[model samples]
Target: MEEKMIVLVAFDGSKAANEALSLAVKHAEAFKGKVVLVRSLKGGADIDSEDIQTAEQDLAYAEQFCRERSVPFETHLLVRGCSPGEDIVRFAEECRADEIIMGVRRRSRVSKMVFGSNARHVILEAHCPVVTVK
Candidate 1:
């Protein structure tokens, strides 16, 4: 049997992220594969109970969306002390992901430089194809 296509999606409880998830589902369905939703957080003092709770809620929302579509899915919350991009790339490498999907916002170069765009990092660093949703 052919190896199942693994579509890795970066989820962050945002509208753009939801759009990315929708695109991911379409890709997974086309390939007869599964969707892996990932959310990353810089742990320790960077995260709090409310943040964790919000993340879980986000994952749950995505899970329900996948289930309703009858799409095979799994979710991951990475609490590693790293940027979301790094966490996502590492997880993709570990899972042998076929593609990585993420949401991006329109921002000035200065804004990106100040905030450090995760989509930009993932696009540059991921071993597989990277898809961006705005």
Candidate 2:
């Protein structure tokens, strides 16, 4: 509580992601810290122009929310060629984040395995504590 908290939020424009953002903002506001919102894309064939546009829109929306709440924030659109989980984990370490906030969608075990759960990967790989929002 003595030091400013650096809260990293994984945002993807979903309801769950929005919930995570809200939580991050509350934490930052209470601690007089900062919030870092990150959206990850693998680029290339994995993502299209529409995806890029949506990411921008989502980032803008989150930015507006933070501005309205007077919460200090940063927005990062990461296009590194890796899984979202890896990007998030690496980014957190790079920024030396105090905590990570993200959302977990209910998925069948098979689906998670096929799609690769970013939350699971992040929980296992991140150096910082991760808080998940439904």
Candidate 3:
């Protein structure tokens, strides 16, 4: 049996994240791979009710998006007191994903220094190759 390729997409409901999802679907279709959509619920706050509901809604949207494209996909919500970047990388590793797709925003150097960059962290820490869409 041939090993299947998995594409991991980090989604946060942003336009750039939508683009990343689209690109992941395209890759999945082209490579006959599966897509994994992940959303990180940052911080250790007892998994806020609103956040859980929002994640459910977002995952539903992601599922529909994959269904429309006829792509095989699964969704994961990470709320284990980890940063989004850490969650993304850890999920990718756990899934043995062949590639990771993420949305990146243009941040000024000062802002990046002050706030840190999740995309940057993922890019640096992920085991597989990362594709970033702005």
Candidate 4:
């Protein structure tokens, strides 16, 4: 039997992330693929239990959304004090994803260079094709 095509999406409950999630669902429908939702927390001394709880809620919402669309999906949380971009790319690689979908916000080139953009990093580092939704 053929292996299932996987579409990985980076989500954080922001508008852009939600947009990415929606697009991933559409893409999954088009390709008969499964969706994987990933949420990354920049681990730090400031991160508290409440933060993890909130992240879990966001993932739950994402799961419900996929279920409403009748799309098969799994959610993952990455919190190893790593950059979101790195975590996202690592998860995609581990899953052997066929494609990655992420949300990006407009940023000046200089600002992006100074304060790295996760979307940009994922685009550069992912092993598969990446789709960005603003």
Candidate 5:
């Protein structure tokens, strides 16, 4: 029997994230694997009703996306006092994921030099293989 793969998809409600979601669904379907969609809320972000509602919407959209594709998946929202990249890596470890899929915004040299990339951080820290979608 083939090994059952656990895929962790990191979402931030960006177009790149949506692309990662799409790829994750395809991969999961092909491998007959299970997908865990995670949305992280960084610390210091406001937690008003509107913000909570927006987070719910993001998870809903991800769930809908997988449903439309007939992908077997689960959804989770991680709201801890950590950076997005850190949260993703930690969650993947906790879930014992075989792979992680996340969106990456291509940054210019100046931007990358000034501000570190979340995708880079996760890639460096994750124990599992990471797939970054632009």
Candidate 6:
């Protein structure tokens, strides 16, 4: 039998992220693969205890979503002092994921210039194929 493909999905509780998560779950069910939900905390932010608690809540939601769908899912919370995009790429590499599903925000040129796009960076840097949900 062929090796089941491993899929890594980045979930940030955004609408696009939720869509990507749904798509990843559907694809995993169809392909008989495993799904890894990765949530990364960016550096330099003074995160309070409440913030961590909120993150845990989000992770729980992701887990529940997978359980409801009966899809194999794992949750990974990465606390590296690095950009979220870079961390996601590294995690994908470490997991040997066949594909990555992430969300992309529609941004104007001015916004893109002022705030760099994480989705863009991930698309450029990731070794595995990326599916971005807008």
Taking the tens digit of each residue's C-alpha lDDT, what string does model 3 give over 19-85? 9999999999999999999999885746679988888788889989999989999998888788899
Comparison by TM-score, 2 against 3, better one = 3
- Give each model a TM-score: 0.96, 0.94, 0.95, 0.93, 0.90, 0.93
Candidates 3 and 6 compared: the better one by TM-score is 3
**Could you arrange the candidates by TM-score from highest to lowest?**
1, 3, 2, 4, 6, 5
Off by over 4 Å in 2: 1-3
Best by TM-score: 1
Residues 68-87, model 6: lDDT tens digits: 99999899988888988899
The per-candidate count of clashes, in order, stands at 0, 0, 0, 0, 0, 0
Candidate with better TM-score, 4 vs 5:
4
Q: In angstroms, how far off is 34's CA in candidate 5?
A: 1.2
Off by over 4 Å in 5: 1-3, 44-48
> lDDT score, residue 96, model 2?
87
True lDDT of residue 67, candidate 5? 88
lDDT score, candidate 4: 0.93
Task: Give one digit per residue, the lDDT tens place, for model 4 in 1-134.
Answer: 87778999999998888999999999999999899999999888989898899999999999999999999999998897889999999889999999999888898999989998889889999999999998
- lDDT of candidates 1 onward, in order: 0.94, 0.95, 0.92, 0.93, 0.88, 0.89
- Distance (Å) between predicted and true CA of 5, model 2? 1.3
TM-score result, candidate 2: 0.94
- Candidate closer to the true structure by TM-score (higher is better), 5 or 6: 6
Full-model lDDT, candidate 3: 0.92
What TM-score quantifies how close candidate 3 is to the native fold?
Answer: 0.95
Q: What is residue 35's positional error in candidate 3, in angstroms?
A: 0.3
lDDT digits (tens) for residues 1-134 of candidate 5: 77668889998788999999988888898899978999887746465667667877998999998888888889888889788889999999998999999999878999988987879889999999999998
lDDT of 1: 0.94
